[model samples]
Target: MIQIANRTISLATEPFVIAEMSGNHNNSLERALEIVDAAAETGAHALKIQTYTAETITIRSDRPEFRIEDEGSLWSGRTLFNLYEEACLPWDWHKAIFDRCAEHGMIGFSTPFDDTAVAHLESLNVPCYKIASFEIVDLPLIRLVARTGKPMIMSTGMADIGEIHQAVQTARSNGCGQIILLKCTSSYPAMPGDSNILTIPHLRELFETEVGISDHTMGTGVSVAAVALGATVIEKHFTLDRAAGGVDSKFSLEPDEFKRLVEDSAQAHASLGRIQYGQLANEKTSKLHRRSLYVVEDVEEGTIASSSNIRSIRPGNGLEPAYWDLIIGRKFAKDVKAGYPLSIDHFF
Candidate 1:
């Protein structure tokens, strides 16, 4: 178990929810602070933003390799440099945004893309650090962030077991002691079927660390399912309104949708009680409403008990239903009214 700003990340507690504000602020400091307030209102535990400049992440090159070419991609025909230039949060706004998060009673953190980005976040004293899926293979960057001795959340999107192992090893060898692995599908507006959240539990077992989902799906169902599979943290892109338009708004959840995700995921976690069977203590009254052997009609003293006179019915103040066969051939020892529950003493 790990604690992020007083919120405990463990199966024994409510899932720690994070509202990812990646590029959803639309370059407006006001909107970014609003996003922070909205996330806090939904009971989310943290607000996560990216800490990188376009210049730091990429160079001003028109090279073919720098352009996004996938026809189905969200940023198709856009160069990585230009896309990030428009999407990157300004370095000057970090303190105000994080301060707004604090005012709303929520912790704030960031995904550091490179060495400079890590150093900048350190100035703000971020409580934790998140490693983006695309950066999972960057062992040097992980080592740098780990040396800060803060908890790290690394998203495993395209990373295979070997790569994940190297990253975790790098972090631990440096100084990080608390780590979480988030199962992720790198696709924007990712499909629910592609989520493969069953891997969440396997991640925990494989790395002996907390596990979660960096959900790119369109609804709360996938996130809720992750909690049932032992996810201790859940991260989802959040925005005030998808209609307002932003780099990631196409796949981001609106405020109300994020609230539902928070509530439903918590309910799913609460429902994961220990394994048990048989009647429960709270069900004692309900058990009395079960079917049992009783006198369906009327019988008199010295009368022969038979199937027509006695049968299984509701209201459990009677001989157990299992005794029906044995009592069928017995003679009544006393008279019984139509509604009287059958008892072994009623027969010879």
Candidate 2:
């Protein structure tokens, strides 16, 4: 069990669902508050925001190194500085958004990209901090965020096993013991095939910490599947409308889709009870439908039971089907009617 905001999050029982309002607000404070309300309505346990100014996240230089030049990328041809400029949330909006979350009783947290961003969030007394996948390799930044002594959630996208190990070590060394690693694919719009959901449990074993998923997949399939695989937390970018054209809007989920993700992730987690093999409570009633040995026709007393007289059928109030061969050549002790349940008492 992990405690966040005084609430016990039981990974063994159910997942902690989070709605990532990452640059999905389109720079509107009003929309950010509305997103919080929408997330709360969907029964989400927490709402997340990204904290960083463009100047802090990237340099304003238009150099080739600062530009995203991948042709297949969503934000291709745009410089990192320009991209961050448009995507960055103004620092002033944090208080109103946090206030709105408080009014609605939702946990508001943020992902900090740099040391300065961490300080800003610390001043706000945020319950926890999230480390984006791109920052997983930033050990110094991880140490800075971890020094705050709050619970930390890190996304493991594009990170190898060694890197993840180091990041977890850095946080623990810096006094952040409560940490969760989110299995993520760093692509803009991730594909289901690329999301190795089995990693959720593997990460838990590798680090001995809580594991989750930072889903960027187009739909809720991957997110819901992650819950079934022992994901303690789930974070997905959310927007009021994808058509509104925010930096992450194309890959983010709309309000209705996000609601479904929240509801389905909880359902998936609830369905994963302790390992059970035998007939369950609900299965007991359906046991009668199982096949069992039954008398197929009327027979006179002392008659030899044969294949024609007994058969395996439904309504399982008879000898087990495994006894069919044992009873086939036996003598009938009494007259047996058709549809009668076969039992030892009826055999000689």
Q: Cα RMSDs of all predictions?
A: 1.5, 1.7
Best by TM-score: 1
- Scored by lDDT, model 2 comes in at 0.88
lDDT of 1: 0.92
lDDT of 1 at 213: 93
Q: TM per model? A: 0.96, 0.94
Model 2 over residues 173-289: C-alpha lDDT tens digits? 999989999999999898899999999999988899988999988989998988878888989888888888898989888878888888888788778877889888889889789
Instruction: Mark the regions of model 1 whose C-alpha exceeds 4 Å error after superposition.
Output: none
Clashing pairs in 2: none
- Return the lDDT, model 1, position 201: 87
Residue 79, model 1: Cα distance from true site in angstroms: 0.4
Candidate with top lDDT is: 1
Candidate 1 TM-score to native? 0.96
